[model samples]
Target: MTTEAETLARTVLSVENLSAWYAESKVLHGISFDVREGELLTLIGRNGAGKTTTLRSIMGIVKKRTGSITFNGDQLIGRRIYEIARKGIGYCPEERAIFSSLSVKENLTLPPVLQSGGMGDEELLEAFPNLRSRASSQGTKLSGGEQQMLAIARILRTGSRFLLLDEPSEGLAPVVVKEIGELILRLKARGFTIILVEQNLRFAKRVADRHVVVENGKVVDILSAAQLDSDMERVQSYLGV
Candidate 1:
């Protein structure tokens, strides 16, 4: 069993009583969670449950946010989005933001390095082999799976230790989804801490160490991967699946 001291030592990000809003509309309501170093945690819920808002709140994208967001011992609540990113936190939005004008290679190398630990070009190419073949192709020219891979690959080049991935498996084929899952597992093995926002429960169960269930903008339950099997009824109710 993991001891308290070990868990404390391993925690890389902590969010307590986090609330957020867009313009006048409130989204996340006093949600709290912690992501341990190198652990893959997923935020699971149906539409409008505020899973995406929680990620936006963490990245400092949501301007009107309350409560503590501590990452690597640094307070992130008041920081700018770019500043938060500079602190080694990366956000990959649901849209899979890939610059259409830039080639795959250009897009991959475009992000300014945030830290010294980023993977080199060759290493990155090795990890995402599909990228190497499409090096000269425009970013928007790639298929959905390739675009998703490039979106994530660019972040790896930025040297971000903690990644906030939103809807990575959404609208992808089963084979491609499996590939993405394999990639996530590889990242976890390489010590990349990730918080994934996913509506796909099957995909979440495949890669996440824990699941944080959200409903009506609040965290309703936290379950381990093991507990997921036995607690399906409750999970389904929260997800309305």
Candidate 2:
């Protein structure tokens, strides 16, 4: 009984009653949300509010998790980390996690392509011109911005349709942050869906289509960009900004 419009507007990812823990301490408490295909959604909150934990749980990185995480109609809760990844979800942790020992080229080419339609090395280099210049340099030798760029660009080669980016703009120079923002916009234009964990509200406002506010390990609010603009006072109160 699904209408054509509803089918066209189907969610690419869905999480319901999702809870996670580190050892014995529960971090996320029944967090739930949906991400439409090609939408840019952001998780924003004060420190230790479980924004990153949600992303990790979605990627199966946080093994001690409960509830449902479905992607394109497939259940992901019990899947292995690699199994989940091969289902076309790419993760860029807050740490960037570039291989310190590998050259930029090597790091960029390392991940095996998990699906069709991934960008080739040349295409990725063209998209991130600075990476082309640092091709021969070790990952550790790159600037903070370049390292973050490498972290994101490396995943594009995997043909991932969904991207979980954790604090991508954290600790970067303003100019570098602007560049990363532009890059994200570009990726969105190419029909990629993204879930971002951003501490910089200003930056998130510029790139995200919608915002999900998390507090005390739960999704406390969901707002469209327009709603956020009009209700920023309430949003700021929730974020304790």
Candidate 3:
């Protein structure tokens, strides 16, 4: 766990006036936020409030986006998805898009290693014991928790220092949700900057260092984990939880 002072010193990603579109419909209307190195932050809001679009825009997956996304002091306004990934940003969407046609091991080894220092086979297995046991199992055969684990593990193998995870704990059982929470804390300790999109405010509270509350396609509030505790009522009103 990093102190607030330490987190502020590293500023990793800055999103300024970011607007995005799905065809002609605007989803994110000039939302702005910053992510600090080694910090785990969450974008929390009701469904359709544009949290997913925010992550997609930062990852350069949303093509019709307009804004200045500065990462490590470089502007990422018009970079392609692969270009952004090569620059060390990994995205694990809500769908947990691991290939259903392949074995777990095959899915793990498929993505091109974008940089050095990625987790090797041993490390990946150690972090996720379920995957270790199901190495040869077909992707579709695993449980939802296992699939989410595989999605996260595959990204860790990419050596990407930054990660964008959308709704990782959604539709998960209580025990499995707890496991995901623990894994997120472990990744933060390993020094990965993460921007998470989560609807479960309780789960978000357990894992994130800060929370950015979105409503109607824009940033309505930003609170530290400490601030969130003292101002729970206000934030809950925004989330309608």
The Cα local distance difference test for each model comes to 0.92, 0.94, 0.91
- Please provide, for model 1 over 1-241, each residue's C-alpha lDDT reduced to its tens digit, 9 standing for 90 to 100: 3445446657899999999999999888899989898889999999999999999988888889999999988999999999999999989999999999899999999999889899888999999999999999999999999999999999999999899999999999999999999999999999899999999998999998889999888999999887887778989988887
Q: After superposition, how far is residue 37 of candidate 1 from its true place, in Å?
A: 0.9
| Position 109, candidate 2: lDDT | 100
TM-score of each: 0.96, 0.96, 0.96
Of 1 and 3, the candidate ranking higher by lDDT: 1
**TM-score, predicted candidate 2 vs. hidden true structure:** 0.96
Backbone Cα, N, C clashes tallied per candidate: 0, 0, 0
Q: After superposition, how far is residue 240 of candidate 3 from its true place, in Å?
A: 1.1
What candidate 1 gets wrong by more than 4 Å, as runs, is 1-9
What is the per-residue lDDT of model 2 for residues 1-241, given as tens digits with 9 covering 90 to 100?
Answer: 3235434876999999999999999999999999988889999999999999999999999999999999999999989999999999999999999998899999999999999999999999999999998899999899999999999999999999899999999999999999999999999999999999998999999999889999999999988888888898999998788
User: How big is the positional error of residue 148 in model 2, measured in Å on the Cα after superposition?
Assistant: 0.7
Q: Cα deviation in Å at residue 163, candidate 3?
A: 0.7
List candidate 3 segments past 4 Å from native.
1-4
